[model samples]
Target: MEVMQYAEDALTINLGNEVDEKINRQLVILKAAIEKLEIEGITDIVLSYTSLIVYFDVQKTNIEKLKESLSTLDLSDLTDSTYSYKVIKIPVCYGGKFGPDLDSFKADGLEPEDVIARHSEKEYLVYMLGFMPGFPFLGGLDESLYKARLDSPRTKIPAGSVGIGGQQTGMYPFDSPGGWNLLGRTPIPLYDSSRESAILYEAGDRIIYTSIDEDEYYRIQEAYEKGQYTVDIEYRGEENGA
Candidate 1:
């Protein structure tokens, strides 16, 4: 691991140069460890794919002191099962209006139905949330379903729109311009300003997609809009996504 002063009062602890589960696991554990230390002056801890930025209050601590404190952290024991994880089920309606770009995969010689099936077959890992608020950058997409970005990005992709770009697949948490190939949309709200926690998923979580028909999609959408639907979440060893 490498520690560098990111700002006048912030430090970045880098675990690796690439995105991986082990790297994210280290980040989660390190964040917990730092919080457990109760290091005075620490104002905030922000996590990324493979690093975390620690913001501090200069009045209570200096760079050297914080570095000294971090240098002693015991991370060698951070193993596969050391940290907990959640698996979230995201129901999606592919093709037709929901997945306008579902036909894009045809260039790779795969049908939309097969693409949806393969896409939902595996559990994807949440590497980080970026590009927008509550937008999760997910990993573990089926190699066969890989596709390039649209010739032109859409002016506004509706929230919960699941799209694929290169080797990655993620959802647009808000209605925003995006270039990813949109294959489907989910009824669940990824970000709700009214909720105590606005963002649904975080890094280190896992996600699994399930296919739903148009009728089912509308049913979920209606219930969700009426605040009558509550997405269930499992404990450790469960969910992912945006």
Candidate 2:
């Protein structure tokens, strides 16, 4: 890991070269250090897919103090209590109205079952939350299922739609326009502005998708809309990316 001090109030830490679950786990380290300083002014702390960017107020905290604070941060020392990450199992229904790109994906040398099997076989890590509120940027897709995004992005992708664009896969949390090739739809409502924690998944959590039929999806959808259902969660250990 390499740490670079920028200007008088910013420090950038490089964990590695790529974005994945492994990199996302490093957020715990940053949160732990910041909590210790109890600094009066923290402008912003942004965690990208692979690096940690911390912005502080020069008026309240100096570069030397910031550097000293970062030096005490040991990635391995972060307590499990300091970070709250959970593994969530998202139930999705694939094919037919849910996945219009089914046949197209099959043509990419993948059978419909092969597609589902490949997608659900491993637990993915939530690398970051972006694109839309509560929508997680997940890592851990079976390379066999890799496919490019549609040449033309859909004018409107329904909320709860699951998609694969490039080497990654993600879920749509709101009814937004997007370009990812749609593969399925989940009944889970991932974001609710009224709730205290509007976003269901955050960076560093694990995610798994379980296949469900149309009938189950409808039942869950109705219950979810009423705020009576809770999404199921499943956990799996970390694996090194090849």
Candidate 3:
């Protein structure tokens, strides 16, 4: 790991140079450790695929002391230990009006059912959240389904619309202009300011997609809007004897 000063009140630690699950896991462990410390002046901890950016208050802490504290940490235990994570099951309505770009994949020689099956069969990892509020950047997409972004971005992508851009797959949390290949949509509200906690998922969380019909989609949407529906989730503990 390499630590370098980022600004007057922030430092960035480069955990690895490439994006990999092991590297990301290390960064998560480190971020958790720093948060547990509750170090004075440390205001925020931002994590990327292979790095952690720590922001601090100059008035409360200095670089030397912070570096010293970080150097004393032993990350071996964290590296060896298994971590418990939440798995979220998201319902999606693929093809037709919900996914305008579905035919684009068909032209590429992929059947709609094949596309949906490939996408929903695997569990994905929430690598980070960016591009827009509550937007999750998920990893673990099947390479066979990889596709390029549109030549021109759409003026607006509806909230909850799921899409693929190159190797990445994610959903739009709000209506915004985007160029990802539209695959499906979910009814769950990813972001809502009225809730005590707005965003539903966080980095390190796992996600699984389930295909639903248009009628069921609208039903869930209505139930969700009425505050009667909750996204399905499973809590998995670390492996035994880890």
Write one digit per residue (lDDT tens) for candidate 1, span 86-152. Answer: 7888899998888999987787899888898899957888888888888888889988977888889
lDDT for every model? Answer: 0.85, 0.78, 0.86
2 versus 3: better TM-score goes to: 3
The residue ranges of model 2 lying beyond 4 angstroms of the native Cα positions read: 1-11, 56-65, 76-84, 234-242
What is the alpha-carbon lDDT for the whole of candidate 2?
0.78
Best by TM-score: 3
Q: CA RMSD for every model? A: 3.2, 3.6, 1.9
For candidate 1, what is the TM-score?
A: 0.91
* Top-scoring candidate (lDDT): 3
- Give the TM-score (vs. native) of candidate 2: 0.82
- TM-score (C-alpha) between model 3 and the true structure: 0.94
Q: Predictions ranked by TM-score, top down?
A: 3, 1, 2
- Comparing candidate 1 with candidate 2, which one achieves the higher lDDT? 1
Instruction: Rank all candidate structures by their lDDT, best first, as comma-separated numbers.
Output: 3, 1, 2
* Model 1 ranges with Cα > 4 A deviation: 237-242
Looking at model 3, report the run of 10 residues with the lowest lDDT sum.
233-242
- Global lDDT for candidate 1? 0.85
